[model samples]
Target: MQLLEERILKDGIVKPGNVLKVDSFLNHQMDIEFINELGKEFKRRFADAPITKILTIEASGIGIACLVAQYFHVPVVFAKKAQSLNLDGEMFTSKVESFTHKKVYDVILSKKFLGPEDHVLLIDDFLANGCALMGLIDIVNKSRATLEGAGIVIEKGFQEGGKKIRDMGVRLESLAIVDSMTDDSLTFRPNN
Candidate 1:
């Protein structure tokens, strides 16, 4: 995870509203090598779990999920933020509040992809308010799939999302747990 922490320090930017911009190597302009490392780390952290599938949200989570899916040798299922005509009848839906976009979205996942037979590992690029992960958790619950754990690249430790999920007995693994950030400075939590 040092590679990821270093990347954040070198290229990440901070906004006034507590957003850490990692578009340079994560959501936007991606670094495939670093992404692979993320895959490796996630695999290492959750190695003991029987991960049957990888679940993530669309757009940003796609790339990271794909990379991590390679390590798990499982399929990646992404929840769509917008309702699509391509969607079929059977689906699981939940409302997710976006901290970045400052709005709520009705995220949907096809029922065909998730079921009681699967053990899901949720992955994402960031965790702030726990809303996004909660929406995914809701879908998993509805499908009756066993939740294995969660893999997050960067977590705003100052926020309650990580703590919230952990409190629910979910094994949440965040590569870099950032405590806070200022104009150009960031404070990260020491590894436990």
Candidate 2:
């Protein structure tokens, strides 16, 4: 986690409106080595949990989830932000509002991917308002799968999303938690 905090300080940019644009290493030009480290850390943290599957939202979450799945040796399932023409038949859908994009997405996952016997680990790039996480949790509930836990790359600690999910009694882990972000500076919560 210290490595991630260093990376955030070195490469993460704080934009206006509390948006920490990590396009330098995380959001855009990804550092594969760093991602692998995160994957390893996630595996270590959730070692006791029976992670049968890894669930994530489309786009940014996919890369981190895929990398993390390697350590878990589990299939990664991502909730698509857009329903494609190839997608049809039964699906579990939830409405999610994106704080970054300022838009609503009908996040969905195919029923075939999740089931009662699986333990789902939800992953995401960022946790701000918790809407996306809640939507994924809803899908897992619909699948009747056991919600194992969640792992995140970065979390906006000033926001309420992470707290809400934790209050729901889910074990959530974020590699780097940003306690505050201004137009030019960023602050991270020290992970004990």
Candidate 3:
């Protein structure tokens, strides 16, 4: 995770409204090698869990989740932000508020991909207010799938998201946790 922290310091941009834009390597134009490294780290972190499926929300989380799914040797199921005509079966839906987009979306997941037998590992690009993650967890619960854990690429430690999820007794692993970020400086929580 030190590699991720270093990368964030070098390439991540601090925007107003407590936003950290990692579009350069993490999300927009992805660094495949770096993302693969993250996948490996996530696998190592949740080595003991029986992960049958990797669940994520669409847009940013899909790429990271796919790479992580490689390590688990499982298929990735992303909750779509918009309902499409291709999706005909029953769906598990949840309302999620995006911290970055500042809008709420009805995230949908097909029931065929997830069920009571699945042990799901949720993956995401970032965790700030925990709305998106909680929404995914809600979907998992509705499907009766066991939530093995959650893997996050970057977590804003100063935010309540991490604490809230941990309070629910969910195992959450964040590659780089930013404890504080200023206009010119950023502090990371020590990995312990």
In candidate 1 the C-alpha lDDT for residue 83 amounts to 90
Where does candidate 1 stray beyond 4 Å?
Answer: none
Off by over 4 Å in 2: none
Candidate 3, pairs of clashing residues = none
Which is superior by lDDT, 2 or 3?
3
lDDT of each: 0.94, 0.91, 0.95
Each candidate structure's TM-score, on Cα atoms with residue i matched to residue i, is: 0.98, 0.97, 0.98
Give the local distance difference test score of model 1.
0.94
Query: Which sections of candidate 3 miss by over 4 Å?
Result: none
Model 2: per-residue lDDT, tens digit, 26-136? 767788778989999999999999999999998888988898899999999899998889889999999999898899989989999999999999998899999999999
- Pairwise lDDT winner, candidates 1 and 3: 3
Candidate 2 C-alpha RMSD relative to the actual structure: 1.0
Indicate the worst ten consecutive residues by lDDT in candidate 3: 96-105
The candidates, ranked best first by lDDT, are: 3, 1, 2
By lDDT, the best candidate is 3
